[model samples]
Target: MEQGEFALSDREFNRVKARVYKEAGIALSEAKRTLVVSRLGKLIRTLRLNSFDDYLDHLERQGTPADAQDFINALTTNLTRFWREDHHFTHLETYVGQLMQRRPRGENGRPKLRIWSAGCSTGQEPYTIALHLLAAFPELKRWDFRILATDIDTNVVAKAASGTYPETELSGLSPQQMALFERAGGGQVRIPAAARELIAFKPLNLMNNPWPMRGPFDAVFCRNVAIYFDKPTQGELFARLGALIVPDGFLYIGHSENLGAGGGNFKLVGKTIYQARAQQKARDAA
Candidate 1:
C-alpha cells in the first residue's frame, strides 16, 4: 500500500494481516492496508519506531501476548447493540413460550433452555437475550437459563462482562428495558444485576483448533461473524456449531448472511436463520 510514497510492501502487510485473520476469523482485504498501517502506526510511534520493518522485527521477536491482544482488539470490530436483530428476540420469545407451555410448568418446573451467543463481542447481545427473557416472561425467575457469551478478543469480553455501557448506547433499547439500566458515576450505564447474572463471558478463539468449549445449546446466535471468514473456514465453522447446537434448536445468523453461504450444515428455519433439525434436539434429549 502506497501512501505519499511511504508504502507497505506485500510481505510486510500480509504478515500483519495474516496474523489477524489467523487469530480471529477476520480477513483483511487488500483495500484495507491504509487502515492497517494507520492503526499500527500508533504502536510504532508508541515504541518510538520509524519504519515498518522495525515494527515487524519487534512483533516477530518481542511482541508478547499483550501485543497479540492489542493487535486483535484494534483489528476486530466488536460493535453490537441490544436487540440489534430484533426479529431474533421475537423468535426466541415464541420458542421459549412454547417450551414453557409444552411442559406446562413455571420457570422452575421446565427444563432449562441453554443458549450460546457466540461472537458476542461486547456483551450486549447476550444481555439483550437475558433481558428479553426476563421482561417477556416474569416467571423466568423460576427457570434456570444460561447464556454463554464468548469472543476471541479478551478485552472486549471483559468490557462486556462488566455489563457497563454508555448512555447513548441505550438508544436502541426499549424504554422498559432502558429503565433497568442505571448510570453509575462517570456516566456509565450498568446492566441490571439480574441480566448480568444470566451470562458467563469467556474468551474463545473461533479459529483455534480444539474449541475450548462444548455445548448442547438449545439455541445459538452466531450472527454477522462468519462473513469475515473464507468460505472453507465458514463452512467448517458452521459444521462445528451445528454439532454443538441441539437438534430442532434454532440458530440465528446475521441478516445479510444465508445458510450454507460457506457450507451446508443447517436447514433454513427463518429469515436468515436455521435449525439444527428438530430431530437433533429431540433425539439428543431422548
Candidate 2:
C-alpha cells in the first residue's frame, strides 16, 4: 500500500461511481472526479493496488464485508461543513421553538418532539440541529428527545458517532457554538455533551432494499440526498419518506432539489422545504 498512487482511471472511477448511483441512487456527478481521486485514490495506492480494475477484482474475490464498506465509502460525497445550509438550522431552531411553545401537554407535562437528520454525513447536520435545539430550549436538559442521524458511510458514521471533528470543520461555528460543541485544543475540536447526546448515528443507505430504518419522524432532514436519483427513483424515495414522516411533520431537501416530480405529499413551507400533506395533519389533529 503506497501513499500517493491511484490505480483508478477517470473512466473506471465513473464506472464504479455509476454503479453506486445505480445501486443507491446517489449521483456521483462529473464535477466530483477530483474529490474521488483525492479521497479514494489514496486508498487504492495505500492498498498497494496498481490498477483500479485489479482493485475491483480483488474486492470481488478477497475483500471482506468491511472492505466493501470502504469501497462504497470512497465513492460518497462527504464534503460537509458545520452549518452548511444555514437556513435549515435556522428553520429548525424557529420551528422547534414554536413547537415547544405550542406543544400540547400530555397528562405528565412534557414536550414531545422528534427530529431526524437523514443522510447525516459524518455528523455535522445533526449536531448542528442539537446546538439549535439546546440554544432555543436551554431547559432541554430536562426533555426526552433525540436526533436520529444516519449515513451509509461506515467510516464517517463511526467517526460521527465518536463526536470528534477536525479544526477546519469548526471554522463555520459562532463563538457561542464553538464553546458549546468544542474543546479549544491545538488543531482539534471535540463535540460537547449537548450535541453528542442529542444525536445517534447509524449506517444507512437511502436506496437499499427496504429502507434500513422506519420513522414517524416529526421532522426529517434528507438534504442533498436525492440529487442523484432519476425522476422515478426520486419519486418513489420521497413517497417512502412521506410514509415515515409524521403527518404534520416537516421534510427538508437540499436547496437545489425539488420534490415536485417526486410527489406533492408535502406542501412548500420554505425554499426546498415542505410540510407533510394536509390529510396527514388532519389525521394527527384527530
Candidate 3:
C-alpha cells in the first residue's frame, strides 16, 4: 500500500469496531472510520502488515499480549493537560477542606484521604490534584494522602508514572504552580517530588468487572472517560463508581459528559460534580 493510502473496507471497519468495543468498551460509530484507519495505519506499517485483514488475522491467531496492547494503545485517546478543567480542582480544594475539618483523626493519629483519578491520561489530572491539594492544605503533608491514577492504555500509564512532560505542557499553570515542577533538561519539566510522591499510576480497564481497589475514596475524578462507552456501559460504570465512593464524597466528570439516569446514587452539587448518596440512603433506611 502506498503512503497515506490506507483503505478500510466496510466489513473491515465493522470488525475493527466490534473488537475495540468488546475489548475496551469504546463505542466507535460509523463516523470513526477515518479515525480507525488513520490511527491503525501507522501501526500496520510499523508491523509491516499489508492490510487490515492481515493485521486482524494476526491479532486473533498469533498476536502476543504486547501486540494486543499496542493495538489498544494506538486506538486509545489520551488527550489531557495539567488543570484542563480548573473548576474541578477548585471544588476539590473546598471539598477536601471541609472533609479535613469534619473527619476525625484516624487511630494512627493521622487523617487519610484517597482520590482516584480514573482514566487519568498521561498523569495531569492526578498530579494536578496532588499539587493543588498539597499547596492549598499544608496539613495534608502530615496526613496519609494518596492519589490513584489509572488508565486503560498501558503506554499512557507508563508516561504518567514518569511524571515528566515537555515544558509546553505547562502552558496553563500559574507561576506558583509552575514552581511546583522541576526543570527536567531538554525543554521538559517534571512534577516535583512532593506531588509525585503522592500518586500511584496503574494500568486499568474500566470494562473489567470487580475492580481491584476496595475504596471508600474521598473523591473520584473520572472525567472525560465515560463518553467513550455506550449508554449501558456508562450507566454501569457510574453505578460502580458510586459503590466505591463514600457517602457525600465528590465525583467530578468531564464537562461534556453527564450522569443522566445512572446518577441515581449521586446528587448533582456543582458543574459536573456529584456527591455520592447511596451510603447515606442506606443509613437512612436503617
Candidate 4:
C-alpha cells in the first residue's frame, strides 16, 4: 500500500485497542477508532508497513521496551497548556500558603513541600505549578521543595524535561505571570532554572505495578488523565492515589472526572477536587 493509503481493519484495530487497554488502562471506544487510525497511520507509514496488522506484528516481534513505549506515545493524546485551569492554580496558591505558614522553619526542620503532577504532558502543568509556588511564596526558595511531573509517554516526558515551549503556548498565561519567569528567544520560552529546579520529570505508566516512589504527597494533580480509564481502573487508580497522599492532602482531577460510585476514602471538597479523609488515612496508617 502507498503512504497515505494504508488501511486499518476492524480486527487490527481491536487488537491494538486491547493491547493499549492492557498496557495503559486506556479504554478506546469505537468513536476513537478514527483517532487511532489517524495517529497510528503516521507510525505505520514511517515504518513503511502496508497495514495495521503488519504494524502489530512488528510490535509483537520486536517486544523491546522502547517499542512498547513508542506504541503508547503514538496513541496517547497530550493536550495541555500553561495555567489551563486558573481556578485550580488559585486554589493551589492558597493551599500552599496555608502549608507554608505551618511548615516548620530552621531548627524546627521544615517538611519538604511536595506535589505530584501525574500524567503531566509536555511539562507545562508542572512548570506552571513551580512558577505558581515561586510567585506565591518566594521564601519557598529556602525550603526543600519538589514537584514530580510524570507521564506515560517517554517523548512528552523528554519535552517536559527540556522545559521549552513556543511563545504561543503562553496564551493561557498573563503578562504579569510571564514576566516573573525567565524567557528565551526565537519565539520560544524556556522555564527559568529557578522554577525548573523544583521539578523532576519521569516517564511513568500508571497501570504498571510497584510504582517507584512511595509518596505521601501534599497534592496530586491528575487532571484529564482518568477519563481514558474504565470505571474499575479509575477506582483502582484513585484508591492508590488515596494511599499515596497525606491525610487531608488534596487531589485535583480534570473537571470531567469524579470520584464516582466507589469514591472510597476521598471526600469531595471542590469542583473535581477531593481531600483524603482523615479517618481513612488513620485507618490506613494503622
How close is each model in CA RMSD to the real structure?
Answer: 3.3, 3.5, 1.8, 1.9
Per-residue lDDT over 46-102 for candidate 2, one digit per residue giving the tens place of the 0 to 100 score: 788877777777777898887777877877777677888788778877777777777
Task: For each candidate, give its TM-score against the true structure.
Answer: 0.88, 0.84, 0.95, 0.95
Error of 4 at 214 (Å): 0.6
Tell me model 2's lDDT, rounded to 2 decimals: 0.77
Report every candidate's CA lDDT: 0.80, 0.77, 0.89, 0.87
Between prediction 2 and prediction 4, the one with superior TM-score is: 4
* Error of model 4, residue 13, in angstroms: 1.1
lDDT of 4 by residue, 46-146 (tens): 88888889889998997577777888998889999889777888888988889877776645475588899999989989998999889888889888889
Question: Which regions in candidate 4 have their CA more than 4 angstroms from the true location?
Answer: 1-3, 105-108
- The digit string of per-residue lDDT tens for model 3 on 166-259 reads 9999886799889888899999999889889999999998988889999979899999999899999899899889888888898999988988
Name the candidate, 2 or 3, with the larger TM-score value: 3
TM-score of candidate 3 versus the correct structure, residues matched by position: 0.95
Model 2, residue 274: what's the lDDT? 87
Model 4 poorest 10 in a row by lDDT:
102-111
Number of the top lDDT candidate: 3
Cα lDDT for residue 125, candidate 3: 93
TM value for model 4: 0.95
Residue pairs in candidate 2 whose N, alpha carbon or C atoms collide under 3 angstroms: 1-46, 1-48
Model 3, position 103: C-alpha lDDT score: 82
